[model samples]
Target chain A: MRIPLSITDNIQEWLVSMMSESAASYVAMIIVALIYLGIFAIAGLFLVLIERRVAAWFQLRIGPNRVGFQGLLQTMADALKLVSKELTGTDRADKFLYNLAPYFVIISALMALGVMPFTKEFQAFDINIGIFFLIAISSIGVIGILLGGWASNNKFALIGAMRSGVQTISYELSVGLSLLTMILLTGSLQLSEIVEVQKGGWLIVQGHIPAIIAFMIYMIAGTAETNRAPFDMVEAESELGAGFHTEYSGMKFAYFFLAEFINMFLIAAIAATVFFGAWLSPFGITESIPWLGVFWFLAKTLVLVFLMMWFRWTFPRLRVDQLLTLEWKYLLPINLVNIVIMAFIVWQKLIIQI
Target chain B: MGYFSNIFNGIKTLLTGMSITGKYFLNSRKGAITQQYPDNRETLKMFDRFRGEVIMPHDENNEHACTGCQKCEIACPNGTIEIIWDRGIDEETGKKKKKIDQFVYHLSMCTMCGLCIDVCPTDAIEWGQNFENSVYDRTALTRVLNEPESKVRAGIED
Candidate 1:
């Protein structure tokens, strides 16, 4: 697949020609890293505020609209408070692992963010194995949850972490399978390539029933993978007090909190890219203006993000057994059948190609 | 068929739940119950019958209806009301009359039960709906109902 030339690509070429190729590449990596960090912080703040406001609306209350201009800076203020808080650990806790776990979770989420195609040319690493890399890195978040729980020396934390481990492992299959269903349609694993294929229409509209089923399955599994509510047995405040990060305080706790929202974003972004057209304007309305691709991508991602938030507010947390049953009994089987069906559709050339 | 129907039912119920929340989310413009507190203070009036605090109303001449009646003080379960009274000469009649020196209301201690207001014979005390009564000091919460240099209404002398 030929890489589409964008402003950033032009800058990269100029830098490589002017400087040592290796040094220029290193600088480019650093630049992308810094951009992603800024994005993570802003998106984390925005998503948390949106979640709180949406939850409030659903429950007939006004959420945090006091800090700055309808509570825009509420998360920023919360981050400050968390940073200033005293870092406390239990007496029997393994201090090293307890401190290290949050970074593991945060880094995994950050790695996933790196590969996402924000616009036609605006991607950090545009890897050929984008979906594969995303799936692989996202699974690593469970290790942090496990380590935090085990190191806490608390029974509730252990239970929460174990539930999280079980939940993530079970749902990951459905996430992969659903993506595979779409990958069959696109015949490419590259994020940009997958997106380029959607110029005909979105995979959802192109493949119809199978693609829609894949989307539904992906959403359920992705919500569980993110450890969000209805599937949030991991942090079930009513059952296990604060879950895996029970003993963590200060910025370490903030990392775990922020990472959840960031992961929620990655899930939505992926959904927008693979199933919906990544940065493709609906009916190519704004195709002439390349910069508008970023707008189209964000508008699509926000819609999916809103859907996830709605799920969090509307649905009750499933029990540990119920959570497993939901994935194993319902989602997993449906996903398997859906994939076979999608393959058949692709082979028969039933797709509504433009 | 049963297996597929069960899956369909599950999806249907989940969609049903989503629709309900979707209705609230869309209807939020009219359905939002939030009373934006400080911002709405200008128009935010409490109900007429709302019991917030016990207050004694005074007219333009600074004359109150309370004639040192000890009934309110006795009716108060929390010992919240303290009426300090002394015998004084009534200027018009040249006769000794019981007069109130201080009507001390310990607002912090008062339960806002309205019993004192109910027991008042002169109907001097009524529920005040000014609920924003937070104070910095405990002593600051102890309020004097009667204005300085004010006397009881002449008609209420019994």
Candidate 2:
């Protein structure tokens, strides 16, 4: 029998025993929110440092070695500098929307983090429809980009925002269908249930051929969704001079920057959970050590994160027309065919079991 | 068939590109092209032929080869060199001879063209490798190449 190591559940029971039910829930909610906020900030900072270091290596340069042991404190120094900078905007810009845009992006990313199964029972909000919740929440971040671009009163920013809207809408279809392909094998929307299903073998192994295809498509679409490079027409630095965030300065810009890295982490986390067996050790090597699940989960997620960074530094940015052509002409059609194939394999019960 | 081939070829090229970068990344410590300037000052050496500035070399007896012929002063395109001369009695020959009282070099006006060094009849001046020429005061750049009370070498011919 498998050991039940539910730390969050234990916390909930302890809180309920100490106080009235409603009061305990209120305190628990606040505590969980604060903890997630801390995770979001720290994860974003470290991802930025990792991205710079990886990029430096790919280009054959020593990146940021002076700041606190291989540039560990570089992002902290950058964040501090950003926090103290003057907040500036165009004189005639839409003040209300301009101020509100960053919150929409950051909050959506934080909400998506809520459902991530870092380990058994470690998730903050174990929603029943976890995959659907993630898809829905991720799409909301594009609205913030659109709003920030439009309210800046700059033509380039507006153009960038519009391109972002178009790109996200097109890529969202592939991301959804790819996940839908995997959902056929697992037959569940809950992330925790999905991980439990992978106890026998990872969805990638059991669902083999089509699962690999879906993963490839998912990675491609996910990179586009995050507005990262090779698909970074949204922030086409050479073309748009920082794109949608051209007018923003200081902490407001930090919110947009941090939200991006957080979104990247979310994409990698989702891929780890759904395809690579979330927190499950390979062949249950550490079955008795339940806490080791967190370690396994993060290790898998960071490998995928490094893969995304590799893509960012390796591939050149796609042109605007080329970007649309890729999603519509290439990715979407392949994605549709891949899902049907997955369905057939599941129906035939041809999956490899451990 | 053509469509499938096109996609396959595209993916192949992308992998090729990734392999090149991946190789570099793995060997980054050995492959980095950047030279940390100030940190590597101890090992930094300028090429021997690098024209930094003109310097007049003196012998152990505080004697130079310059007869104050003013050839460098005439060859200097920017008027960077000036020589002050005096008629002095040559002790060995009992005859009057022209000798430089002051051999002033204005580093600020020099373009490092090496024309003055080339025109020197007695090989009085040669290039110095000290290129740290920055100075706060403009007058500090003007230097006298000859030491005080120094004379031309005994065996030097006019």
Candidate 3:
């Protein structure tokens, strides 16, 4: 018997076959949500492990290797430790908002993960406004940081949160504009449709010069948006003493930590999907085997993730003023000009076709 | 003109920084400077002159080099070494010789300065390389350098 390639489709069919239509849909939604949650947790943990290992390597040291074979279970152990820790709060903190903050950050990141096309048909929610949804959802994560910082009733936390608000707002422009440049090439807002357009050739290859610039700008902005190092004004440990989540302890702290890694993965995944061909095998070598698309997608995403990790380890954190200068002075201007270039290229039918 | 040049130079410097780290990352297997202690105990070797602790070397005959000399005790800055000695007749020489009843070493007070080893007139004491000195009880840090019932080596001039 030939194995079905689309596991999601097969699962959907099985669910429908076994239950009433409405019930099947409900069951499918529940199952998909559960699966995405599992993925979010596992991916966050795995990315943290990867970041630690990569950071260690760059610093000429061995990272965690004693927990489980090459420290595979280190993050798992950390998660357990975090869960068992006492949830502490400041004496005079805003109780309601402080308690409510981490969920906002974590839920926003989890929602963004729903639309990622891991393979041809593996996406949980393949909404038509996929890119827009991601952009909108990702921006909501800033609210969590702001709330966490404000409700903590600490000066440093407030400063960090305010810096984050400023940084995210500024970089958000470059991120949208750069992705907007690519959108001009694909002429579609749908992520899968964007990937389908790349079947002729990857967007980066087709729209070579401008697309490369957009990719670079997108990477910079995306890294900033995630509040990662070099752009981690949100949690500038030296300046803000753990920043927005300073008052958070135990599982609440873990939620913020996990969400950061998830956001990094989201940024890299978006870069992988939009710039590189999402789940499309390079040169159609693995085209016959549709299942291999998942492998390719993950491999591409991991490469971008490693790039982000590289940036984190190599670059020092930007000063608050310098951060804004970079966004407004360099990235914004370049992104604006690149979008126009991309538009001109599209108008002249100058895109490279395979 | 300079505006664009500044951007280019900035990116170039950033790339240079990345290349340096990237080089180390690629060569990390051979370049990692961390030594996994305990796990690598069998292979780990301290330097020859590392002042881990003061020790008295004894032979197969249970004879040591120390002759109850107070030089180490006197040389120790913090009085980490203490010698309780008794005058005993040497059978071969038929003379009174100072022999240690207990050669106590307070490792807690010892700074590992090698002063005690340097000042031992009979070349009795030397540095030991066993540095895992932690103990639950404070009294456990006080060590007896000479083995119980051990005698001084024969044919050594005081």
Candidate 4:
């Protein structure tokens, strides 16, 4: 299933019941790490395949189809090829961070799953300020990307990494402001509690127009934060070869690639949680049926992922100046205003009568 | 004042931009551009002119019209073709002749130059639609002729 933390919870529960309660926490952490690696491998394969198909449709062209059924196994074949390929290091490249960056990026993204709520009952830590924790961890991923770019000793790599670092930091403000509105509405920052509140009716419906506006802002800022197109100045193929990780090879390169897709899913899942109401859909309508909420949660996330793919394929990459303008001049100010209005609404009850 | 105007303009722009995505999202039906390729390959039509693999044409008696002319090989810059020849004696005329043992065209190496067919004086070859030539073995690209030796002899006799 697409659920990340539920499996971790299941492991924790089994360990607690079978073994001592204290040791159960240790078992749970280990299980979460295994799941982190397992999910990253599987999801990266699926993301690559989906991206090719989505690009194909947008451009009215056929994508890879000969390797497996509709090229479903194409990424696995690519992974195999990558494993066998020899890694070439630049003669002048820094040996340490060049090797360390990919693992750092992957681990930082994996840390995000620790706070992400997959279902009502499943969360690793379920910190009261889970949304803030998620943002903080995702931001660390940019550091790894930046290190990889700088360590590569290539001009393009350095440029890509620096661009990525700046873009991520700037867009984070807008993303944070958008989520702050939801925090104001729910009044509690715990992810499970937020999902529980949405059980009666989703935040999208209950919070109404403001929630949707926040969602739109979140999407724009989130896309930019992840270094996804059209804000993908770091990986601009025309100007830069492979961007920040250009000098990386073998599983190290694969790790960086995995981190990107996982980060994409993280943003999509968190967006679904905060703004689209986590795993809730119209109470009794979905609650009566077992596993319906999980299905709806996944369906929502996949739709968001498809929208991301459409965006990457259809739009041209933005200039660095224009990209920052979009954030500072447009998204940041709008979100700032949105937060103020939302806070005002909560305090004064300015929401229109039904 | 300028800052507020900027913020206000942003909200308008964001809404206008979101409305476009939301409108399409709300209006979209099934067939969300997900094409199941193999299932749909029956309806797949490439224009008659796509330069894929080259094929040698065989007559009703299975005689290929190629006379082992090296013009196509000379014209090609990539050296994708290597026309192998086998010397043989005609049974009916007691005359020695040079025949193609293999008109080996490496599909991977081919740049789809179509010069091979154009240079063939006998109209013996043309581009074919069978593009499913990808394989694990690189050597599988050398296509053996469908034309029988008897038919080739008949053509020589004619």
Candidate 5:
């Protein structure tokens, strides 16, 4: 059968071959899934290194220069150390739940990879509900934190978990509301659809004043949701004694650490997809280049991730009350009202006319 | 009326806050405030009052003026110093000399507490202001600063 030819024609043919007389498509999909997981781990390692470097710059000191070649392999060494060390379980705690929490966090973060369309041909699943699916899966990492905290039977851990729950739930509303503004403008739930709309230009550049404002709102709320600094009160070292993971030791603690970094990348990647254009370049020029979309997308996300790490190192963690106030008093009302106005403007076709 | 004005004032305040950041961001012609250290250590000089490595005062013949009083040793809480003593043979008076012997100062164990200097009676010790003391071996850090016999004799006669 003759297929309608396009730029992804070669990719389509390869996928079709996998479906005929073999379990090749299933095997290929698993390989692609593992590739995405590898990307997550690699990104997490780089993010951890970047965070330390930025922190060193902020505090006017050199950081982690002793590890492999200006600390390039610091994360590798750290992971090896964590793996070799003991993973202790609390005697008083529910052993099943305690053992289960880190897995929950790691699995959910890995699940977020399924919805992310790395390129048109590079996605694991071409699901229609990709954006919301990402949001849903990534949020489960928070439940892991709460579970780990509660199961440990440590007072500080419980308090930290409580803080994380409140913070996560609060910031989630602002993020949702900010992103809702974009969904209203673009009129799609799927991330691929959103990227399609931004074929001409990234949303940050294409959409006028209101869209830019929404982008800023999303960035701030996403940073908080990632539990990075300025919003890192959940694990405020001074206040809560390592917060929710206080009772955790060795490998279980390592899982929690890895989860935090992966979530940071996930949020950044989602932000790249939503506001900056997933894998599209300016003026729909990427259609000619074939791979420019994915390149531009990864580059943009890495830049955003670096900026988030910079913010983490530059500022002291905000007080819990101050954090709540920023969300409730400022971000919430602005995003809520902004979406309503954007909806009206989009419906009337005022965006193009004006 | 005043409360409504406060909202406008709030907007103005935010703009003002943004403008300060704006000015700094735009002023790229100005040199960056960051300094890459260790690379630029050749021209580095500590401030006048910066406390760094400790030095013992030496006589013209290269000898320290410390006696075996062990006051500084007593003042050091971390036991970073070990003052070994030996009876001095007197050629004229035929009596033991109350002079310092082996003055061992361990840099590894040093907390940079200046209490030893504070307790010194001879005004022989002061901060060296030389802090590039990273050595290859731990044993190299354990300094044994004893006066040579010739210099000790010259100090006693003087």
Candidate 6:
């Protein structure tokens, strides 16, 4: 197959010309991984600032605008402060797992960033099982929260960890089923193929009610998966004293904090890629400028991210039982019915053709 | 049917909450109540009667109104005010009168209760309305209210 002249392909071509094929591919992989790491670090800081500012607006207060222009350096200053702090853990805590937990969370989040098709040609790895891989890897992040909580040897952290474990497992089903409903319409699990099929129009537009229903379910499940408000039982500070990572301090604590924002960005990016056209401009007006694909993709992802932040600030945290009931009783049944309806629509050729 | 209704009600409530926050967010341009403090100090104005600190009133001629009766000193619950007095000859009356040599106000100790202002027979002390009271040292806070080289106004009875 002739390789498309994308950014990744250019690097691959250069490396292959300079070195052996295997070495080239290996080097390219390392480069892409490093790029994703930087992207997550910057995106984490940006999303936190936006979330805080949006939250301030919701509550009729001005957020941080002092550190730099409009408080842009606030998160940077925060990162520096965290770096300077002494890492502290409980005396009886399991040292090994406590040190390892943040990596579990951060790695899963960064790995998800690699698969996202930023533009038509910019995905690090366009694996055939894109959606499934995303779902699998993203769900593993809760393991870090679980380990962090358990290793702390604190009851609140342990309870928080257990709650997160139950919450993620239950919510994963709804997230998977909802995405499955969309997959039925697209007939492909590969993210680029899904985005390609939506060239007819975004899936939410073409597939009608079932697609919209799937999107809503996906959003709710995604929010829960990220451990955000309304489903933030894992770190319900008022009740659990920051829940799972209660004993974590300094840079260790910052890793968990940064991972939460990075995970939020991943969830938003995935939703934008799969449901909305990943890099497609509205009405295909900007289709000629393929490089503008990155801009379009970021715009769509940020809008979704803002929507999630809105949900976070507006809604209160759910009780643990209520959270479980939300997934099993409300979201799960709706997802099942929605998938069936999507199947019927596809079988009958009721999907809108461009 | 009841199950569906319950779900609908739950969503409706959630939407209602979102709308309230959305209204505030959208109207933030007009509704933001932040003063931006130091930046707005030039335009910011305190209420006319807001009691911020104690000050002895002086006229343009550098003559003060204090007779040093010590009523304010007596009325202050916190002992935040001290009146130093000495008998002096009134220029107009040619009579010996009690006049304030110094009116010492320890702003650090002042509770801003306005009792001294209320009990002043000569209406010498009143609220300054200057609330920026932070100082580098405690001694800086202890202010002498009377301007240097000023005396009690003539024709004012002791």
Sorting all predicted structures by DockQ, with the top scorer first, yields 3, 2, 6, 1, 5, 4
Candidate 2 per-residue lDDT, tens place, A1-354, comes to: 112223445665688899986776666777788888997799899999999998999999988877898889999999999999999999899999999999999999998998889888677777779999999999999999999999999998999999999999999999999999999999999899999999989999999999999999999999999999999988999999999999999999999999999999999999999999999999999989988988999999999999998899999999988989888988899989998899999999999999
In candidate 1, the residue pairs with backbone N, CA or C atoms under 3 Å apart (3 or more residues apart, or in different chains) clash, namely none
Best of the candidates, TM-score: 3
Q: What is the DockQ of the complex in model 3?
A: 0.64
Q: Candidate 5 residues A239-333, lDDT tens each?
A: 88998888888878887888888888788898899888888765566678767767877888888887676566545678889889878877888
Q: Write the per-residue lDDT of candidate 6 for residues A1-354, one digit (tens) a residue.
A: 332324568788899899988788778788877887887798798888999999999989898999999999999999999999999889888999999999999888888877788887788778889999999999999889989999999999999999999999999999899999999988899888998999999988889999898999999999999999989999998999989989989988989999999989888898998889989998999998999999999999999999999999999889988998888889998889888999999999999877
Report fnat for all candidates as fractions from 0 to 1.
Answer: 0.65, 0.72, 0.79, 0.00, 0.00, 0.72
lDDT of each: 0.89, 0.91, 0.90, 0.77, 0.76, 0.89
Off by over 4 Å in 3: A1-23, B47-106, B110-129, B136-158
Residue A5 lDDT, candidate 5, scale 0-100: 22
For model 2, residues B1-158, the per-residue Cα lDDT tens digits are 68778778988998998898889889999988666668987877777998888899999999998889898999999999999899999888899888899999999999999988888888989999886789899999999999998999976763
lDDT computed for candidate 1: 0.89
- Cα lDDT tens digits for candidate 1, A170-206: 9999999999999998898999899889888899998
Question: On TM-score, who's better, 4 or 6?
Answer: 6
Better of 3 and 5 by TM-score: 3
TM-score (chain A only) of candidate 4 = 0.92
TM-score of each: 0.82, 0.82, 0.83, 0.71, 0.75, 0.82
**Model 3: share of true interface contacts reproduced:** 0.79
Candidate with better lDDT, 2 vs 4: 2
lDDT of 3 by residue, B1-158 (tens): 69899999998999999999999999999989888997999998887977788888998999998877688888888989889899999898899878889999999999988877777777888888887889999999999988999998986653
> Local error of candidate 6 at B31, Å?
3.1
Q: Give the winner by lDDT.
A: 2
How far is A143's C-alpha from truth in model 1 (Å)? 0.8
TM-score of chain B of each: 0.78, 0.76, 0.77, 0.64, 0.67, 0.76
What's the DockQ of model 2? Answer: 0.60
TM-score of chain A of each: 0.96, 0.97, 0.96, 0.92, 0.90, 0.97
- In candidate 6, stretches whose alpha carbon ends up further than 4 angstroms from where it belongs are A1-6, B46-130, B135-158
* Candidate 2 lDDT for residue A146: 99
Winner by DockQ between candidate 4 and candidate 3: 3
